[model samples]
Target: MATLVLAACGTDAAAPADRDDVGARVFAANCATCHGPDLGGTDRGPPLLHEYYLPDHHPDVVFATAIANGVQAHHWDFGPMPAIGGLSDDEVAAVVAHVRDEQRRAGLME
Candidate 1:
């Protein structure tokens, strides 16, 4: 289970309905094991729903970069994140969109 943290701005902009679905599917297949299906913290990874993941600290691009290059452990004790392979650029974007949408729904973002 790898960690995939997605972030969102405080703006009201929303992801498209279709992209949201695709992103959710992609997330379930690749990220849910660690990140949880609801972006909640699992034993294996930190929660994206927390304030630490606010867009001010981690913008949407951070998610794409993390998935592409992985991240070192800095905020949590879970250990470094490993790069997620085999995702296309569009899939990455879709995952970001999904994460942003979930963040908004959880009130972590505007």
Candidate 2:
């Protein structure tokens, strides 16, 4: 039974994710708790779907840094945000991509 299970699992542990799903997957797992399921604001966190977050204003680096180093509550009333240290730079990038895509879709880019 163990051999059958292992055989079904295959040898490649690092299977690639579908290109379109990367950002959302990362976001759902890591950022969704605070940022909300639809990237909208929650009681604990501000909305990423707002115009204030456009890359021209907040920039991608800001997102990366905020996730890595945490954020202070200067813009919203959510209070200070703490650093999320478990996510890697790549995962952070993926999360950022997902957020930017969401931001665009929300018409926040305008």
Candidate 3:
């Protein structure tokens, strides 16, 4: 797995409310099925807010790729995530921002 630093997104002081709204919408529309509404993970997927993931995997580029292209099922057998082709680059960025912020608030991101 890649060790992605959280600082790359810059100071966590820019448009937080907007990020949260975008993030919630993106997650609801695309990730809620697998990741769950509260981001607590689900039977079909691992928790995004867990200590094992959020901190190390929150890089913008990595997340962008994961959302835009989908990830290969390397650590789990559930399978790769389908490409969220419906989202534009800006939308993807917002989602990533949302995930990072929420994780950070949850004390999962560093």
Candidate 1 global TM-score: 0.84
Q: Return whichever of 1 and 3 wins on lDDT.
A: 1
Candidate 1 lDDT over 71-107, as tens digits, reads 9978999999899999876678788878888899998
| Pairwise lDDT winner, candidates 1 and 2 | 1
User: TM-scores for all candidates?
Assistant: 0.84, 0.77, 0.77
Give Cα distance to truth, residue 34, candidate 2, Å. Answer: 1.5
What value does the lDDT take at residue 44 in candidate 3? 82
Please give, for residues 1-110, the per-residue lDDT of candidate 2 as tens digits.
Answer: 22322232243243324322765787888778888999897888988988778888887777877887888988899998888777655566666767877776777764
- Determine the backbone clash count of candidate 2: 0
Q: Rank the candidates by lDDT, best first.
A: 1, 2, 3
* Candidate 2 residue pairs that clash: none
Model 3 worst lDDT run, 10 consecutive residues: 1-10
Give the Å shift of residue 91 in candidate 2. 0.6
lDDT top scorer: 1
Candidate 3 — which residues are off by over 4 angstroms? 1-14
